[model samples]
Target chain A: MDTFLQVLIAGVTMGCIYAFVALGFTLTIAAAGVVNFSYSEWVTYGGFFGVTLYSIVGLPLWAALIGTVILCVIMGYVFQWVVFRPLEGRHFLTIVTATIGISVSMGALATLVWGPYPLTLPTFFGNGTVEFGGISFFPHNVLIIVLAIALISVLQFCLTKTDIGLRLQATAQDPDAARLMGIPVRRMRTFAYCLSAGLAGLSGFLVAPLFVVTTTMGFGLMLKGLAATIVGGWGSLKGAVFGGLIIGIVEALGAAYISSEYKDVIAFLIIIVVLLFRPRGLFPERIAEKL
Target chain B: MRILSKSVIAAALAMSFAQVAFADDIKLGMVIGTTGPFAGGEAPLVNGTKMAVEDINAKGGIKGNKIQLIIEDTGSEQTGAINAYNRILDQEPSAIMNTTVSGFVLSQMGTIGDEGIPTLTGAASAQLALDKKGVEPLFRVRTSDLYVAKAAARFAIDNLGGKKIAVLRANSEFGNSWLNQIQSVLTDKSVKPVAVESFEVADRDFTPQILRIKDAGADVVIVSGDPPHFVVAVQQLKQLGLTSKVIFSNAGVLPTTIKLYQGDSANGIYGTVDSVPAIDPARADWAKRYREKFNIDSDYSAAEYYDGVMMVAAAIAKVGTDHEALVKEMRTIKDYAGIGNTYSYADKGDGGRSVAIVQIGDGKLTLAATIK
Candidate 1:
């Protein structure tokens, strides 16, 4: 029972990270109408930004996170303007290829700037463990779960119960109709892009303390997040959350109960099974439907 | 003006040709990961190689022919490493120096064998020696993983008084070889590991494995892997509140790896190191010079490669650049003092024979015992 509790905590923490990154994917896909694969780079850059502010510049953690998120939001705005605006109506492959190019370029740029060494970030609670009933839990793990739930709740509330959120969803659902109804489609896309980038930045900051920050760290998370997005059904926010949590739990439980060697294969195996059965993901509904 | 420009260009070309013609410099190829996973560790090796080449050249060269070091980036992938090797081979270097990644070396063995160039690497996989019977030109500059595993296993059982043992390793060729060596060492002592687990090199989360180890009630855990895998594993194990005595492979004790550990998690953990400069005061001058030159702490990985380059130079000085002659000379070198160890290439191309066990405490690695 103690072992199960430990595994569950780890699985949930990992699931939250994946869900956070997947949130970035769903937002851009919904509002921008483009699957921005470069969300991973945003995650990487966000971590670097936080590292610089928190570790290098010696700011408090909260201030650093806020600064990092703001910087990432600006980066997203620029990214959309520079990469997406020029080729907005082009073939889907063209934009995706450009985003891919951005991803590769950002990785190289990170290496050039940061010099390829893994940078360490201090944990929010300073590596203190909370134990109960002979089971141990890292304070950061509990913090991740809480923060993720809070962020998701805040996002859900704004999107469903707020005016600006409705406009954004309207723009995403039918841009032509939204424009006819006096909703600035371009502005809505830009807003969602910036918000998504901010979310990516938050994910990076949250993940930095858990894993050493490396230029290549984003790639693995990106792959997992991409998988989570697909498993949850692309463009579905709830799907992203469920998918991320499920993958993380399966991976933890699989490694614990079965073979550690095939743990990754097990998490991915769920994706295959999901795709085979649900096809649209576990939620089987788009963000537009939720709105 | 045109005539003058043409004359200037002609003079430049003539000087370049004259320099090349007059200077028959020996070429050495350095292939390492400058951009990928191993880049952090491999960077120091590059610095060491560069320092060696520069020092040798400044000392009037090898028999009046200055050494020209050609460095290439491997990108820390097998394909990238192979491409780097091919690029270096285009220069037809007299010898090649590779990184500490065993997988890269294993992948490039066929090419290195075909080229028949004397190759030196710090990769610690014991499989290299097992495969060295047919490959004459390959030499391991660092202590083999087998020896480290043996030393770690023995220290864990005898020194730390550990009874129930757990083995957690990276899922790689190096890790697999180290696990086998540890198991073999334990078997000789009639002991069995309580649990054995492996994680991917890129994995950041290790709680699942730690939980399993805790559940097994292992008193000691032997971790076989490189940094940041080693660094993260130790941190996670500590974070997950495991009080087991932990032993790590050589990479665990590195200054780069040590500096990344969260809080005092690394304080009580034991790790294997190829050399302890503190034990040998003779390394002070070299360490000081390295610090002054590279602006970084001198590590055994760097020292091994530095010694490797110097050893290659000594062999070239003895038998010239002939590959077979140099190989023979390298084998004949006895008690060649280096920054890390007194390297004398063994029959199986293992130059360094000893491993030092160190315990991390108070922000430094304190040498506990030297195992031979």
Candidate 2:
């Protein structure tokens, strides 16, 4: 029972990270109407930015995280204008290819700036293990699990029960109609981009303590998050969350129970099985009826 | 027409003079991992190479002809390693200083042999030194994994008095070879490992593996992984409260890795090293110089590279610029005291003959024993 609990916690913690990254993917697909493949690079940028502010610049941890999120927001805004907007009227594949190129360029730029050494940020709770109700946990792991849940819940509330979110959704559903109805479609899309970028930054910050900060860190997260997004439902926010958790939990449980060497294979096998059966994922996106 | 002929003749004469000067300088080529997962280890290796080049030139270079050092970055990938090798070869160097990655070296063995360049490497895999295809010109400048693995297994059993060992290794050629070597040593002693597992190089979490090791009730766990992977494993092992005496391979015992690791997690951990210049009084001068120069503590990889370059310089000095002659002279190197270890070039391409076992106390390494 203790072993199961330990594995569960590990899985859930990892799941939160993947879910956070997957949310960015789902948001971009919904609002921007195009997948930003560069979310992977944005996650890496978040880590390097955290390292720069907290480790090199000596900012307090909370201040550094906020600064990182803001930087990512600005990065998204600039990218939308510089890269996305210029390529918006072209084919969808063009935008995706450009985003992929941007990911590569960002990775190279990071290597040039940070000099390729894997760095670590100091954890909030230090190295002390926390014991609660007869179970031991790394305090950072607990922090990741709790903070991810709280932030995700707040984001869900803002999206589902707020005026700006309705406007954003209107823009996503039909930008031409939304523009005719006095909604600033361009600004709405920009906001979605910023929000998603901020989420990616937060995920990267959360993962930095658990993993070393490296230029290559985001690629793995990107793969897992993309898998999660697909498995949950294409563009459904709730699906992204559940999908990430499933992948993380399954990966951890498989590693613990079956062969550790084939852990990734097992998690990916879940994807194959899910796709074969459900096709559109566990929770398919709902399309509103046309008049 | 007369003026044009004069200018052409002058240009041709100057070009020939330039070529003569270039030929007078001995070009030594190097390929080291400058990016990706191997970057931390690359730091010391690069610094050591730089220092060696400087020292050799300052003492009046090989045969009074200054050594020209040309380096290429491997990007820590197989393709990158091969590309770096080709780029270095384009310079038409006298000899090539090899990459520290065993897999990288193995991939390029045929090319290196075909080129017939005297190549020296710090790669610890015993396979590199074997009498195999296209490895005749390769020389290992560090202690091979066979000796390091033996020392680690022996230390775990004899020094730590650990029984019921568990092995967690990276799923790579280097990791598997080290596992085999260590297991062979254990089996020779009539001891068998309780459990064994493997993980990819990029894996960050080791909770599953640690829990399994705990479940197996292992008294000792031998980990074969690079710095980044090993650092995570150590932290997770501590987080899960594993009481096993953990032993790590050499790459994870470097100063850069020690600095990245949380201090408490590293305490009581034992690791094998090619050298511990920090604790070895004989290497105090070199270590001090390295720290002052690079503003970083030198690890064995750096020292090995330094020794490799110096060995090449020595070979060039003894046998001039002839590659075959240089290879013969390199093999004759006996009791050549380097900053890392005293090297004697064996017939199997081995140079360095010793390994050290160290224990981490409060994140700092203390030399436990040196095995030769």
| Candidate 1, CAPRI quality class derived from DockQ | medium
User: Residue A132: error of model 2 in Å?
Assistant: 2.2
| Per-residue alpha-carbon lDDT of candidate 1 for residues A147-184, written as tens digits (9 for 90 to 100) | 99999889888887898888887877788889999998
Cα displacement (Å) at residue B158, model 2: 1.7
TM-score of each candidate structure, all chains considered together: 0.92, 0.93
Return the TM-score for candidate 1, rounded to 2 decimals.
0.92
Give Cα-based local distance difference scores for all models.
0.84, 0.84
Flag regions of model 1 displaced more than 4 Å.
A285-291, B1-24, B130-134
Q: How well is candidate 1 docked (DockQ)?
A: 0.65
Task: Give one digit per residue, the lDDT tens place, for model 2 in A57-138.
Answer: 9999999999999999999999889988888667778888999989878877887898766777878888778877656798
Candidate 2, residues B44-73, lDDT tens digits: the string is 777888899999889888767888899898
Best by DockQ: 1
lDDT of 2: 0.84
| Model 2 CA deviation exceeding 4 Å by range | A286-291, B1-19
lDDT of 1 by residue, B1-372 (tens): 999999999999999997875479899999998886678878888888998999999999998889999989888889999999999999989899987788888888898778878899888877787355336678888888778889999998988898999999999888898899999989998999999999987777888888889889999999987677876787678767789999888778877778788878788888898886644577888888888887767788888898999999988888888888887777776767788876766554467877889899956888888887
